[model samples]
Target: MGAPDYFVILAEMRTGSNFLEESLDAAPGLKCWGEAFNPHFVGAAGRREMAGIDIAARNADPLRLLAAIRERTDGVAGFRLFHDHDPRILEHCLADPRCAKVILRRNPLDSFVSLQIARRTGQWRLGAKGTARMAKIRFEPADFAAYLDMQAAAAAAVTRRLQISGQSAFHIDYDALGDVEILNGLCRFLGARGPITAASSRTRVQNPAPVSQKVENPEEMAAALAELSAQEPFGAGRSRSLEPDRGARVPTYLVAASCPLLFVPLPGGPRARIRGWMEALSPGGAPPLQGMTQKSLRRWRRTNPGHRSFAVLRHPAARAHAVFVERILYPGPHCDMDLRESLRSHHGVPLPEGPPEPNFGLDAHRAAFLAFLAVLRGSLQGQTGLRVPPEWATQSALLQGTAQVLLPDRLLREDMLAQELDAMARPFGRQASVPPARTGAEATLSRIHDPALEEAVRSAYQRDYMMFGFEDWRPEAAG
Candidate 1:
């Protein structure tokens, strides 16, 4: 193995891989060859921006640059080496049996924006400017296609190495701290004496862009991609850009035999626990309450013959829950709008996004809030007081954001909140297909303030209609 130990950090750069390299280098026994294949200070630790580095020299004979970084210097001390490239590089790099590699992947949006800026500003390493080009360069990579190709190349290479060579490989997620966690995990796994926490989280954060743009000009970007991912296209499951008919595929199915659970990051810990309780709670497509029907809603009192009969026609949490469950279940674009990328927030964890610049309203805010509530509810495992009311679809109610909190057919109950929330991360219940309803109730509790004010309500519905192929959010206007 190269000195320190061979560390092939296959990653999407700009997602903090440089910060990771810097951290790894800070340790006593480690060194990094920034990007093995790229032109410039190939072995210079930390970030390499085209603005300051020379790509032409490295391009002439990248090997010389690689050598300059003390490549294989580790062949002696058996020290660790970190290369932040894709897994595919093994095809070119002569493998020394002493080395080990890890595939570190990150959310695509984080990389895409960085890439866009690199291309536009004229200093990308594999440097493809995302800027509008006056003249096209075949391989210069002027658009999203080029970015995807680079990302794909790295991913494919990593996968290939794993299959062909029995390299000690790992798939890592990126953080502002770079690959610290994964690197440490691998070091521990390999029994290497390396410092995992050499760099602090604060030092890892790069100067963030003043404003992270969610939607660029409509004409240049793909509407479908924009709808699915505001930042990066990582969450997309089996659904593709052109295939509208494949909406059902969006809802995730947690068939343990088919798909393995993911290890998401948690605030308090290094790696979040893996569990599946969403399936248990929403097995059948949402508690089969006598879903809103025109006749039943019109004759409210008659439909209310029993205590189990009256229910809020539309529940915000239900909407949120349905959307959340769909993502956890099949994960497709047609399942629900919240599952779409448009809902992702610019600052925080992926919160739902609303309509573009032209139209912004309180009702839309309400709907968005309710959708968030659903996320909270669906994600809850009795961790809090919130629970899906046993008679949720039919009776009992609470205002969740703008939408009513219609409990699932089963109640989460004040008492079972703990048990239910503990069961939050997994799937629950039987599978049932939810067909579209004919119409909504006639009168919407006149308390909504104004009939026209309902236009804002239409924001949630209209957004759903446009994104998921659903009928509407809750159309109460007319037949």
Candidate 2:
């Protein structure tokens, strides 16, 4: 309550985090340790230990290092946390109200260009006396688009965690990093007695030229920027021309009529079973409420005093296959005919002109699914012309979108749905067994699935696998 016991600068690579750390360290009794949770090294590059905790020890228990930093420091202690750092420590930091959050951001284009230059020049940092290395890098639209998506995802995750926990963070942009007053204010936020007299001069800005001057293919870069600006006018991640942002699908939220329970549904998951379970919770088996807006959702929450919200997650492999079969491989009421055509012609997905023939068997299914996965890899990275439907978008991205309106209190996995749902329902004096697991798609997938398919799915949904810690899909593991 009296200033955070510790602090973390939530940041990403090439976002001036190092400069901010230098500035914070200038204040007396305000210590900003380097990236203590960076998985590649202990604290800083080429270092193995920090505050007596070595790399092996820290990996075994990151909290041991955190404890050391808090206990050994003479004043407020903190570290920088990039988006790709150890997520276990990130979870602990976000959950602890005593951990002050400093959110740092830069323009996605600038950061992307800087990162590319750094990668080419092998110059990540520049000292006052060190000579700066200059390099002109080629900008690839697909690569930049992927970079934007990664940054957006990271920012959304942090924002949602803070919002749900009722915590606030000090946000500073890249251009403000050199302001002495701003640096002093950050020191005050950390409860430091002394003010930062000036911004630290230990580090120098590595790149100071216009983006056009730094990129070799300036004309292509300009064209790409124009296209991106037209597509995402507000900025990266706000909107997309190719895909309807999933956050706008709040109307899909379902609430129970008989009890204070809200179900935030993620498409391509076990929705039918979950909906039936919600209905069964009612005294006379009334249908669950649907078609909720933000205003209506708030009213529902107000009227139901002790409402609990939840969502279920399906394995990426299973989810992707289900979507491919129902929506892509075969025609259905929900299929986008235009998208199917684009996938077949532009993305090299081999699809029949109509529904599959009787001769279409496991081998045919396997080949088509693999080709679809290749397209999925491109579609997710913004290289394809097709829209990314919620049915097949990464679950992590969908959950981020869900956080914009309502973050579920519990996120249960499909494999553990039976027990988890029972436990959740008991607290509200309503108990209903989950309907039997649906195995139609799982049965088909089992026949065509192999290590190759698993690897292909992993390539397409790498973020989901990393975020959820999902293992390879085994038919026996299917619920």
Candidate 3:
């Protein structure tokens, strides 16, 4: 059989990628693999799972994967493109020039916001062994500024990778392309003509509590949840009501600092089999990295006492806020882990049994971020029994000042992005992490119904912006 002309679709998750990939699948001769290295013995058999399916063995090597890809897609037509978001997928991308490239990017603010949500919600990419790989491989910008700066940094990384390759490719903006236009554009980019339809992007994951539908088959949903829960990475915690924060309370350490912004104490998949592979490829040869087991991670923190070498956590308020906003932006199927479950698991406090709820949108996020500071500040000022560790103040100040101060308002407004610039700015937010002082934004808000107060809401953005090195305002403040 003759080798078919193939195109590779590259981007991180939830960037309208599924819609793009499925468009190729719509063409009669065209076929798309969500994760090309994923089983079905479609490619070379470097490794075999218990089910006897071939999978990519290492993250460092791409020729084997490319060879497998060439071996695949023979005699296939219309369009034979492989879609994936993992950074390791780079090897395969660079390997074959015959395969056209299609790169997708979203607004920096939206993407970072989505990632934060994904962390809390446990929603992950199905492309690269799921979320664990996706998190590590994410090319999004997160340069030391608040969430916004980090987002810009992530965007920039994608741009750099695309430019370095310098291949003829299609670049997509998630906000710009509509369903019909995107699919159609992808067809033209790959030089394949086909009928594009909305059904191509139809997802199997359904909403159980969609507003109008009185669920006729509750049992099916329950069964599915049970099945998913059994395999869940964090496992399931107790169920509770999603009622407004009347009864909800987040943890002190999480809100106050002592953890990185993107922390998940819960383990992902199994322990690392060969961390040495990454070290070999990495500049410093990062030690034989060990993927920790959940039991061990939890136990080690307990025994090590002062030493928390695993599951370093931080940015509860920001992360939780991101989760809330993701719902409004991308209303897909329910995420893997429920929020109440997290409250129970992290704090060892269970909730009363009840139906689970979805994360609210951007407004919820804004409120949460503010409340988190308010709560933490109260503890720090010795209002609550909980004492705010001094480090808490430093981290919060860094986050607030960087995101609000250093960066431009455009980054946070919605859909504004400079991928490369954003990627370069991420390290700033984490630089010199000290407990920062948290002033109560709530007290001021509580007193004023004035529109100027709304303007004040926008003012805090300067603190965060400064960390990212945004705008003309202040390099002096960053130090």
Candidate 4:
């Protein structure tokens, strides 16, 4: 309609969103409120009220504040909405065609590193003095993986909502934040009357150094980033190709520095245990080398002669259940809240509105898992509009994707994982020990194991079953 009644900037932390807000505020007849729906404050940090609505009042009825922002501003009024902000405002804005959406994105690695530095230094913004505090932070692969997952989930949620609603957002990237032409164009999109001659200089770049300089462990950071690039080549908002074929994801390949062992992981398998086993085999129990490219992988092969690459295959039903519990059912960094909501509402999966209650037991979990399996069938076949996550994709398909680059030298079944690993490690004069078995989802699956669940998994992952010769899922048989 008429330039949308107002606008909302859908973004996450450290994405140059604050700079964007400042630029928009500098434009004529355009007003941008800072984090209007941030749970901790009203309009900005340390502020309790906005447009006569206190934090408590805003929490009671967020839409009331939205109305006030629109009514009080003399011209076009808008605000920022982070991924972790109030859900009610997000829901309302996404559905309301009158609310123009502007999405701001940055490299997840940059944002993650920036966020870490910010947390360490407690400097959210910078001035022209450029007298910013600097610190070198260690890069933890596990933490970065979680952060990537969260960013991906947030982007996917907004994207799916816009897609389903048939709405479009004005997308911008962090690098373009300083471009005057792009900022002016954005101002025009927001119905601003005057053109901005220059980008706002109020907020300076806090961390001007390269990522390697800011991180304490450059090698580890490089490895983690390489892994991230291989898994998500295009960052958080990577397009979902419906070709039914995936890339080899070579960067995710793990190799032992001192040993001749390479691990090609199939997501949702016993990756941690495998890593642990591989690490134990390394001299002095060192971590495995990760974040390999095709070129680097070949170099590694040339250097570490006689290296053996291996992959583990878990039963389709067990793998799917693990993915469901970890990535769909539970509320965690790995969980996709949007997908969970869609399953509960659109796919007839009887998931609880929020976290499962203490009373939610085997029966509830079984019913939900069965329903999820039904949806998974469609998802794998491209019938569902959702992207087929690697966590639950058929192992056969994943292996096929891997074969596009390099096939594993050995494929071990989960039931025989420990024995096979021990045998594999024996050549290097080291004995590998498998970690303790997971109990939560495994125990729950065991309690509800039946013919129906097995049938559902078979229907959903016929390729894996046909290729692997897996029988019905037996908890006792699992690794």
TM-scores for candidates 1 onward, in order: 0.37, 0.53, 0.32, 0.50
Q: Lowest-scoring 10 consecutive residues by lDDT in candidate 4? A: 234-243
> Regarding lDDT, does 1 or 4 come out ahead?
4
Question: What ordering of candidates by TM-score runs from best to worst?
Answer: 2, 4, 1, 3
Model 2 residue-pair collision total? 0
Number of colliding residue pairs in model 1: 65
* Best candidate (score: TM-score): 2
Worst 10 residues of 1 by lDDT: 241-250
Q: Please give the distance, in angstroms, between residue 396's alpha carbon in candidate 2 and its true position after superposition.
A: 1.2
- CA lDDT of every candidate: 0.36, 0.82, 0.35, 0.82
Displacement of residue 42 (Cα, Å) in model 1 is 3.7
Model 3 residue runs over 4 Å out of place are 1-4, 37-53, 56-61, 74-92, 124-166, 199-201, 204-479
lDDT of 2 by residue, 257-314 (tens): 7778888889988888888998889988899989988898888888888789999988
Tens-digit lDDT track for model 4 on 295-392? 99888888877778999999988899989999999887989988888888877899998889999888898999999997787565434545567887
Tens-digit lDDT string for candidate 3 (198-302): 323232111111111222333443354355356532111211111111111111111102221211121110012112222332344444323444454445456
